[model samples]
Target chain A: MLIDIQNLVKDYQMDSVDVAALRGINLQVQKNEFVAIMGPSGSGKSTLMNILGCLDNPTSGVYRFNNTDVTGLNDDELSDIRNKHIGFIFQSFNLLKRMSALENVELPLMYAGIDKAKRMAMSKQALEKVGLADRMKHRPSELSGGQRQRVAIARALVNNPGMILADEPTGALDTTSSMEIMDVFKQLHTEGNTIIVITHEREIAACCKRIILIRDGLITSDTPNLN
Target chain B: MQQIRDNITKAILSLIDHKFRSFLTILGIIFGTASVIAMISIGEGTKKQAIAKYQDLGVSNIIIRDKDMTDAELQTVRMKFSKGLSVEDAKVISDVVPGVVSVSPQSEMKMEAKVGDRSAKASVIGVTPNIVSILNYRTAKGDFLTTDQYDRQLKVCVLGASIARELFSYDEPVGKSVKVEDQWFEVIGVMQPKALFTETVGELASRDLNNDIYIPLSTFNKRIPKVNPFTSDVKQLTVKLGNSEQLLPAAVVVRSLLNRRHFNNDDFSIIVPYELMKQEEKETRIYNLLLLSIAAISLVVGGIGIMNIMLASVLERTQEIGIRRAVGGKKKHIMSQFVTEAVVLSVAGGIIGVILGVTLSLVISWTTAVQTTITLYSILMAFSFSVIVGITFGYLPAKQAANLRPIESIRHE
Candidate 1:
C-alpha cells in the first residue's frame, strides 16, 4: 500500500464551536491506482484531500505513507513529504502569476535544491509530457484556461513524486478543456503514475479506475468504477 | 548558499515588479542616511574651522592687553602710579617667568598715511624686532625690521599689504617714502595679508591687521607724540611659551607679575589661546553629540517606516507565502527571503544616500559660508546604520511571514 489511514478525525474551531470536518475515516490506496474521491459541498472531501496530501495533520489518527507514520511528523517533515512524495494540483491552477510556465514548473525542483541546469532540463521534459512544450515561456495570464491547467500539471509532474493529489482538477474548465485534461490524466495513468483526484462531478469521477463517495464526513461507498 | 541566492533573486524580482511601491518604501531610509552624513560632515567642518582659527592665534602663546579707558580713567590710573601695559611688563615677564620663550611688546596709534595725494587711515604699529618671530608675521616684499634698525632707532617702517596697495597701487612700496601724521618714514618691507579677527578677545579689540604699518618702537616713541600724558608706553605684550603645557602656569605667573607692577591695579587682562581652544572643543563636543542623536532618531524613524511597509507586504502576500511554503520551502527559507528583500531595499537606499549626502555637503559649502567636510567614516557609518536598521525592523515582519500556517494561508485567496 502506498497510503494508509485509520480513524482519521479533523475538527475546526469556528467561533467557540468544534465543527467535525472529517469523522473517523479509514482508507488504504495501492500503488499505481487512479482513484477519485467524490462528494458534494461540505462533505469534508477537501479536508480529507488536504490531510492526504500532507498539507495538514489530522487532529487524531494514524497516517502511514510507504509504511512510515506521517501523522506524528513535524511541519518541516511534512513539507519534505509533500515535496518528495506527494505533488498537489489545485482547481484554480495556482501557477505563480509573475513566472513563465517553465519557471512555475521549476519551482518545486528549485525548492528540492536542484542545480539550475538539471532543473531546467527536468521542467522542460515535464512540459513536453503535458503537451505544453511550446508554451513554456508564456506566463499564466497569457495562457488560456486549459493551458494554465496544463502548466500546473507539468509542475506537479516535474518532481516525479509517489502520487499526484489533485483537488477538483477539472472544476474550472469547459467541456472541451475538461476532456483534454482528463485525457492527459488517463495517459499519465497508463504510464504507471499513481493519481488521486477530489471532485464532485459524476463524469469526472467516471474517468477514474476506482471511486470513493463521501457524505456528512463519512465514506458512503467505495467500489471500482464500471465505466 | 544556493538557497540564499534564490531568495535574493526572488526578492529583487518582486521589488522590480512593483517599482513605484518599492521606491516609496525606501524613501525614509534614504533621507535618514543622507541627513546623518550631512550632519556629521557639517560638525566635522565646524571643528576643523575652529581649529584653524585657533591655530592662527598660536595656541602656545599668551597675550596681555591694556584695558581701553577714557582720559579720566587713564588719569586716575596714573595718579595711582599704575603705568598700564608697558614694554617694562614684557621685559619683566621674559626675565622672571620660567619657560617663557620670548616676549614682544607693541603699541598702536591710528593716523593718516599718505603717498603723493592718495591717503588711507592706517594704524601705525610700533613693534620690537622679535615681534615677527613671536607672532608668525611674514614679509611678502623685502625684509622685516632687524635688531640693528630697532637699536639704531631708524625711521624706517613696514607697510601692510592693503596699505601698500592703497597708497602705491601696483607699484612696489618698499624703499618709498610715506608721510605718517607729520613725519616722513621710509617703507622697507610689506607684510603678507593676515586673517581678519572679527570678534574681540578679552580686552583686545578686533581690528583689520592688514591696514597697519610696522615701525621700530624706539622711533615710534620719539616721533609719535602721546595722545595723553597718562597713556602707557606699549598697548599689548605677546608672550610665547616653550610648549603648550606651560601656557596656564605662565599665564598665572604673568598675571600676578602685572598686578604687582601696576600697583595692584587691574589694568591688564591675559588671554591663553590654548585654553580657549580646549574650552571651545569641549562645547562643540556636546553640540556634536546632540546632532548625532537627532540623526540617529531620524534613522530609527526610517526603520519604523520599513517595518510598517514590510508588515503590510507580508499581509498582502499571504497567499504567495503559502504557495512558497507548500513547495518545500522551510520556515527559514521564508524568513530569509523577506529579510533579504529588506536588506536589498536599504542597501540601495544607502548607496543613493551617500551620493546625495556628498552632493548636499558640496552644495552647502558652495552656497553658504559654513564649511562642510564629508569623511569616509561618515559614509561608512551611515551605510552600515541603514543596513542594521533594515535587519532590525525587518525581523518582526519576516517572522510573521515565516510563522504563518500553510494550510490556512493556501486557502486565503
Candidate 2:
C-alpha cells in the first residue's frame, strides 16, 4: 500500500462546538493505481484531499504513507513529506503569476535544495514531457488556459513524487482544453505514474481505472470503472 | 548563501517595482547618516583650527601682566612697600624660577609714528633684546635691536609688517627714519605678522599687533614719561618654559615670586596657555557628543522604517513564502533571505550617504570659511553603523517571515 488511513476522524471547532468534517474513515491506496474520488459539494471530499496531501492532519487517526505513520508528524516534517512524496495540481492551475513556466517547474526542486544547473535540466525535461517545451519561458498570464494547466502538470511531475493528487484539474477549462488536460493525465497514468483526481463530472472520472464515491464524509461505493 | 543572493535579487526587483515608496523609506537614513558625518567633520575641523591657533601662541608659555590699579590702590601698594610690575620683577623671576627658559618684559605706550609723507598712530612696545627669541618674532626686512643699541639708548625702532607697508609703500623700510613721540628714530627692521590672538589674556587686555612699533626699553624709560599715576613700569612679562609639561609648575613658581616681590598685593596675574588648551578641548568634546547622539537617533528611525516595509513585504508575499517553504526552504533560509535584503539596502544607502555627506561637508567649508577634514574612520564608522542598524531592525520581520505556516498559506488567495 502506498497510502493507508485507519479510522481517520477530522473535526473543526466552530464556537466551541466540534463539527466533524470526516468521521471514522478508513481507506487504502496501492501503488500504480489511477483512482478518482467523486462526490457532491460538502461531502468531505476536499477535506479528505487536504488530509491526503499533508496540507492538514487528521484529528484522530493513523495515516501511514509508505509504511511511515504521518498523523504524528509536525508541520515541517509534513512539508518535507509533501515535497518528497505528494504532488498537488489544483483546478485553477496554481502557478505563480510572476514566474515563467520553467521557473514554476523549478520551485519544488529549489525547496529540495537541488543545485541550479541540475534543477534547470530537470525542469526543461518536465516541460518537454507536458508538450510545453517552447512555452517554458512564457509566464502563466501569457499562456492559454490549456497551456497554464500543462505548466501546472509539468511542475507537479518535476519532483518525481510518489503520487499526483489533482483536485478538479479540468474544472476551469473549456471542453477542448479540459480534454487536453485529461489526455496528459491519461498519458501520465499509462507511463506508470500513480494519479488521483477528485471531481463530480462522471465523464472526467470515467477515464480512471477505479473510482471511489463519497457522500457526507463516508465512502458510499468503491468499484472499478468499466470504461 | 544562494538563498541570500536570490533574496537580494528579489528584493531589488521588489524595490524597483515600487521605486517611489522605497526611496521615501530610505530618505530618513540618507539624511541621518549625512548629517552625522557633516556635524562631526565640522566640529572636528573647528576644534583643530582652535588648537592650531592656540599652538601658534605657544602652548608652553606662561604670561604675567600688570593689572590696572586705582589711585587709592596704588597709594596703598606704595605704602605697603610694593612697586608694581617692573624690570626688577622680571630679573628676579629669570634668576630664581627653576625650569624657566627665558623671561622678557615689555612696556606699551600709544604713540604716533611718522615717515616722510605717511604718519600712523601705533602702539609702541618697549622690550629688551631677549623679547625677540622668546616671542618667536622673525624680522622680514632688517635685523632686530642688538644689546649694543639697547645699552647706548640709541633711537632705533622696528616696524610691524603692516606698519612698514603703511609707512613706506614700495620703499625699503630698513633705512627709513620714523618719528616716535616727536623724536627721530631709524627703522631697523620689519617684523613678520604674528598670529591674531583675538581673546584677552589673564590680567592682560587684547590689542591688535598689526600697527605696532618696537623700541628699546632703556630708550622708552629715558624718552617716555610716567604719565599715568596708576600705570606700572612693565606692561607684560612672557615666560617660556623648557617643556610644555612644566608650564603649570613654572607659572606657580613665578606667581609666588611675583606675589612676594609685590608684597602679596596680587597686582599681577598669570595665564598658562596649556590650561586654556585643555579647557577648550573639553568643551569641544561635549559639543561632539551632542551632535553624534542626534545622528544616532536618526539612524535608528531609519532602521524602523526598514523594519516597517519588510513586515509589509512578508505579508504581501504570503503565497510566495508558502511556495518556497513547500519546495524545501527551511526557516533559517527564509530568515537569512530577508536579513540579506535589508543588509544590501542599508549598505547601498550607507555608501551613497557617505558620498553625499563628504560633498555636503566640502560645500559647507567652501561656502562658509570653515575647515572640514573627512577622515577614513568616519566613513567606515557610518557604513558599519548602517549595517548594524539593518541587522537590528531586520531581525523581527525576518523571524516573523521564517516562522510562517506553510499549509494554510499555500491555499491563500
Candidate 3:
C-alpha cells in the first residue's frame, strides 16, 4: 500500500468550539492506483487532502506512507517525507511567478539537495515530459492557464515522488484546458504512477480509475470507475 | 553550498524585483557605514598632524620658558633674588639632572629687519651654536653659527626662512648684511621653515618660528641693549633628554632645581613635548570614541530600518513562503533565504559606503586644511559591522517568515 490511513480524526477550534473537519475516516490506497476524492464545499475534502499531502497532522490516527509510520513526525521529518515521497499540485497552478518554468520545476529537487547541473537536466526532462519543452524559460504569467498547470505538474514530477496529490488541479482552467490536464493525468496513470486528485467535478472524477466520495467528515463511497 | 547559493540567487532576484524599495531600505546602512569610515579617517588624520607637530617640537625634549610678568611682578622676583630664566639654569640642569643629554639657552628680542627699502618685523633669537644639535634644526641655504662666532661675540646671524624671504625678496640673504634696529648684522645662514605654531606650549607664546632671526647669544648680550632694567638673562631653555622614558623625571629634577636657584619665585614653566603628545592622544581617543559611537548608533538604526522592511517583505511574500514550504522547503531553508537577502542588501550597502567614505575623505583633505587618512582596518571594520547588522536584524523577520503556517498562507488570497 502506498498510503494506509486508519480511523483518522481531525478537529478544529472554531470560535472556541470543537468542530471536527474529518471524523472517523479509514482509507487505504495501493500503488499505481489513480484515485479521485470528491466532495462538495465544507464536506471536509480539503481537510483530507491536507492530511494526505502531509501539510497537516490528523488529530488522531495512524498514517503509514510507503510502509513508514508518518504520524508524530516532526516538522522537518514531515518536510522530508513531503520532499521525497509526495508531490503537491494546486488548483490555481501555484507556480512561483518570479521564476521561469524550468526554475519552478527545480524547486523540489533543490529542496532535495540535488546538485545544480543534475537538477537542471532533471527539470528539463520533467518539463519535456509535460509537453512544455519550448516553454522552459517562460514565466508563469507569460504562459496560458493550461501551460502554467503543466509547469506545476512538471514541478511535481521532477523529484520523482511516490504519489502526486493534486487538489482541484484544473479548477481555474477553461473546459479545453481542463481536458488537456486530465489527458496528462491519464497518461501518467497509464505509465504506472500513483495519482490522487481531489476534485468535486463529476467529469474530472470519471476519468480516474477509482473514486471516493466524502461527506460530513466521513467517507460516503469508494468504488472503481467502470468507464 | 548549493543550497546557500540558491538562496542567495533567489534573494538577489527578489530584491531586484523591487529595486526602489531595496535602495530605500539600504540608505540608512550606507550613510551609517560612510560616517563610520569618514569619522575614523578624520580622527586618524588629526592624530597624525598632532604627532607631526610634536615631532617638530622634538618628542624627547623639555622646554622651560620665562613667564612674561608685569614690572611689579618682575621687581618682586628680582628683590627675591630670582633673576627669572637664565643661562645658569640650563647649565645647572644639564649637569644636575640624570639622563640629561644637553641643554641650549635662547633669548628673543623683537626688532625690525631691513634690507634696502624692504623692512619686516622679526623676533631676533640669540642662541649658542650647540643649539643646532640640541634642538635638531638645520640650515637650508648656509651653515649655522660657529663656536668661533659665539666666542668672539661676532654680530652675525642666521635668518629664519620667512624673515630671509622678507628681508631679501630678490637677493641671497646668506652673503648679505641686514640692519636689525640700529645694529647691522651679517647673515651667515637661513634656517629651514618649521611647523607653524598655532597654540601656546606651556609659557611659550604662540609665534611663528619662521619669522625669527638666529644669532649668537654673546652677540645678542653685547650688541643689543635691554629696554627694561628688570629683564632676565635669557628667554627660554630647550633641554634635550636622552630618551622619552626619562622626560618626566628629568623635567621634575630640572623644575625643583630651578625653583631652589630662583628662590621659588615661580618665574618659569617647564613643558614636555612627549607628555603633551600623550595628553593630546588621550583627548583624541575620547573624541574618536564619541564619533565612533555616534556612527555605531546610526548603524544600529540602519539595522532597525532593515528589520522593518524585512518584516513587511515577509508579510507580502506570505504566498511565496507557502509555495516553497509546500514544495518541501524546511523552515531553516526559509530562514536562510530571507537572511541571505538581508545580508546581500547590507554588503551592497557596505561596498557603496566604503567608496563614498574614501571619496569623502579625499574631498575633505582636498578642499580644506584638515587632513584625512583612510585606513584599511576602518574599511574592514565598517564593512563587517554592516554585515553583522544585517545578520542580527535579518534573523527576526526570517524566523517570522519561517514560522508562518503553510496551509493557511497558501489558501490566503
Q: DockQ: which candidate is best?
A: 3
Q: Candidate 1: how large is its RMSD?
A: 2.8
Cα lDDT listed for each candidate: 0.90, 0.84, 0.92
What is candidate 3's lDDT per residue for A48-89, written digit by digit as tens? 999998999999989889888888899999899889888899
The segments of candidate 2 whose C-alpha lies over 4 angstroms from its true place after superposition are A190-192, B69-83, B86-95, B102-234, B242-245, B369-373
Question: Residue A34: error of model 2 in Å?
Answer: 3.3
Better candidate number, 1 or 2, judged by DockQ: 1
- Per-residue CA lDDT of candidate 3, range B1-413, in tens? 88888888888989999999999999989999999999999999999988877877789999898988898899999999998888888889888999988898988999898998999999999999988887678999989999999999999999889989988985888879999998999998999998887777655667888998999999998889988889998998999888999999888888889999999999988889889889999999999999999999999999999999999999988998999999899999999999999999999988998898899999999999989999999999999999999999999999999999989888766
Ranking by lDDT: 3, 1, 2
RMSD of each: 2.8, 4.2, 2.1
Screening candidate 3 with a backbone cut-off below 3 angstroms (N, C-alpha, C), the clashing residue pairs are none
Q: How many residue pairs clash per model? A: 0, 2, 0
- CA shift of A64, model 3, Å: 0.5
Docking class of 1: medium
Tell how far residue A63 is off in model 1, in angstroms. Answer: 1.5
- Top candidate by lDDT: 3
What is the full ranking by TM-score, best candidate first? 3, 1, 2
Listed for each candidate, the true contacts retained, as a fraction, are: 0.55, 0.37, 0.75
Q: How would you encode candidate 2's per-residue C-alpha lDDT over B56-112 as one tens digit per residue?
A: 556778888887777888788778877889998888888998888888888888988
Ranking by DockQ: 3, 1, 2
Q: Report residue B272 deviation for candidate 2 (angstroms).
A: 2.4
